[model samples]
Target chain A: MEFDKGLIGGSTVLLILSLLEETDRYGYEIIRELESRSDRAFQLKEGTLYPILHKLENDGYVESYKAKGERGRDRKYYKITRNGKRQLAKEKEQWEKFSMSVNKVIGGELYATD
Target chain B: MPLTKVDKFLEDVLSHIKFPFVKDDISFELESHILEKIDYYMEQGYDSEKAEELSIRDMGDAKEIGILLNKQHNPFLGWLLKITNGMMIFFIILNIYFAGIPFISSLFSKNPINTIPKEDIVYKIDINDDKIKKIQITLNNGETFTETEFYEDLFLFAWEVDNEEQGRYFNNIKGYDSNNNVIFQDEY
Candidate 1:
């Protein structure tokens, strides 16, 4: 299926904020988490992920610093900011409301009453 | 084959990206991720070439991705970016030129030269109907006046006087031309 660029771009930041809610993660770790958690349904490409990460950093939604990895390679680690957490909560509420309405339409859960 | 294919794919992708950003740490990270994807494909029994092709295909359009990356970090894109930054520098230089027009305009106006520091220079103006026939000017120091006159719709005249106490010469001038220009100066 072709991906909608606009939807993917906007949602990528929200997805980042949501993932950082669980714990601090590096770039690869976050991508891996999204893949596993979505049951391999959302296959995010590498090129897509880094740009969103950079944008979030530029927007002050996240911050990064260099840290030594398990294999001794220096890796950039990102952590959510207070602002990021607040934004995540707001986005989560909106997503829930949106998905609920969408499910009603697509999931056949909504019916007309006589 | 996966490595070879991956290398070619990266070259294509990186070429779409302008210099500097393509070689940044972020670029390295993305490159490693693509290699990892190639490795995963290879694990699934695909040859190196197939694995690399699959990985590149999964990555989608690199040009589109590069544009997104540029938009994120470049800060200067779009028309507003060019106008504020590129044209802003041009506009600042233009402002200096625009600022001089009024100063030049004031030199020709009928108003007395209010900008000059008054020391010991005295200025006089005589008007008859629409024509200015003469202008009298005096300096406190022992010096004389020099005059220049030109004809226009009205006669234009100007003179300069030297002051002793101020130890500087002052230009006390007047014009009768509709279009004003400083036609007279006296150093004596």
Candidate 2:
């Protein structure tokens, strides 16, 4: 199912950072990995990814370098920095707490006994 | 080479970005991404033109992406930095013009006072009376200056002498006519 744009927007940075945590990835690689991991549910607009990547770079959370890809073509690869890893950890904790609280509210089991 | 649809799309996106330095890199990256997508689609049995069209379509609205990219670049910060750089250059030029060259020239001269040619030096005592047509003054430098050169040198001499020494400095001045007859002496 397609998610709301606003809903997906808040978590994109966390998702991107998590992907970059494993290894360096270029723009297309990031998008493909996101889609594959989410089972094609998160079809991010390819153009919008650049602004987020560029923003992450400007904030010093990520750094980019040009390197040859599998096709022997030069590609801009983004690598998460130390700061980005810390940020990802924080976001993950927050998401876990938030989602648990949300599940509790919507699960309707908290007041089921009463 | 003639412009392709992809080139037009890149141009449309890049035009909104005010910062020039980052545009080329952004264009190259985005073009590469689109080309890769087109290749992916062509492998899935789509024709070249169809794959190109689909690839561009999946990138989303060009104007929206451009505006978002512009926000990341922050044109305001870029312009502020540029303006500050320009102001710094202007101040450097102003300093060189007003102070640096004059200081350097002064260093090359042996005596600063003698830097002015002897003929350019003049001392003047103004006679406010309308009847006084010709007046001359002899300075400590043994230079005699007539009324004709008085106006130009008046400001130069006024600040050099204090009020207490004004009368003593003017004691050597004598007024005379075209025939060289002394009209007034030590009366000024």
Candidate 3:
């Protein structure tokens, strides 16, 4: 099923941070990995992904460095910072709480009592 | 390989990025992304021409990407430039206000100021109440002239007047005795 763009947009930072926590990835690698991991459901457009990456880099949550690719051209890679790790942990906690509450509502168990 | 299509694509994308210092790195990154996507397509057995076409198409609109990149590279510059322009306009208006008011007032105030000339004025007047001292007096506006060589009562002082007092001004006159008692007074 296709997800709402808003949902994907909100989760994008979290997903990017989580991916970078394991190993550094360049821009195209991140896009492909996200697609593969989500079974090709999270098809982030090139225009959308780059601006967020630049914003994350500018904000100090991620940093990038250039390394030559197999084709002898520069590939920019991004890695999460210590600050990004903390931000990820906080986001994870908030996501767990939010999802649990959302599940209760979806399951029809949550209702207004008063 | 001629990069004609890629060059056109990049030109379109970079058109949105206003700052020159930021252009090269952003252009490189995006171009590299396209080339990598092309390589992926080629690994799937597509020819170079088709791969380049597909990669550029997959990257979506250049104008859209340019807007995003432009925002990232030079944040707030457009707004700051506008604010700076507005302030310059305000300062120009203020300069005009400071420079124009005196000139406008001079243009509107047309009446020439009247002045008393030193040679045409009665520079000194000495009047005494002595019984035998003769005195000449003039009224600023009256046609009658009065000259007094008086004995008493007014002290019935004989007086003379003349036309030369036309533009001169006087508002008060008084007489006092040896005891400093006010004996006479008049005002016009």
Residue ranges of candidate 1 with Cα displaced over 4 Å: A1-10, A68-74, A103-114, B1-4, B18-22, B45-47, B75-188
Per residue, candidate 3 scores C-alpha lDDT tens digits across B1-188 of 78799999999988988877667888788888888999999999999999999988888888888888788877476457667999999988887788777677656443222133344443234445463233333456543333343322232322232445454454345555555555665665
Candidate 2 has an interface RMSD (Å) of 0.5
List, residue by residue over A50-79, the lDDT tens digit for candidate 1: 778877887788998878677565667889
In the range A1-114, model 3's lDDT, one tens digit per residue, is 568889898889999999999999888888899989999899877656888898888778999999986768878999999989998998888877777778777774453221
**How many pairs of residues collide in model 1?**
2
Model 1 lDDT on a 0 to 1 scale: 0.64
In model 3 chain B, the worst 10-residue window by lDDT is: B152-161
lDDT of 1 at A95: 71
Q: What TM-score is obtained for chain B in each of the predicted models?
A: 0.36, 0.43, 0.40
lDDT of 2 by residue, A3-61 (tens): 88987898999999999999999999999999999998899889999999999998889
Q: For model 1, what is the error of residue B114's alpha carbon versus the real structure, in angstroms, after optimal superposition? A: 53
DockQ for every prediction shown: 0.30, 0.61, 0.44
Model 3: CA > 4 A from native = A108-114, B75-188
Quality of candidate 2's docking, in CAPRI categories?
Answer: medium
lDDT of 1 by residue, B99-128 (tens): 866676656664444444565234334344
Better of 1 and 2 by lDDT: 2
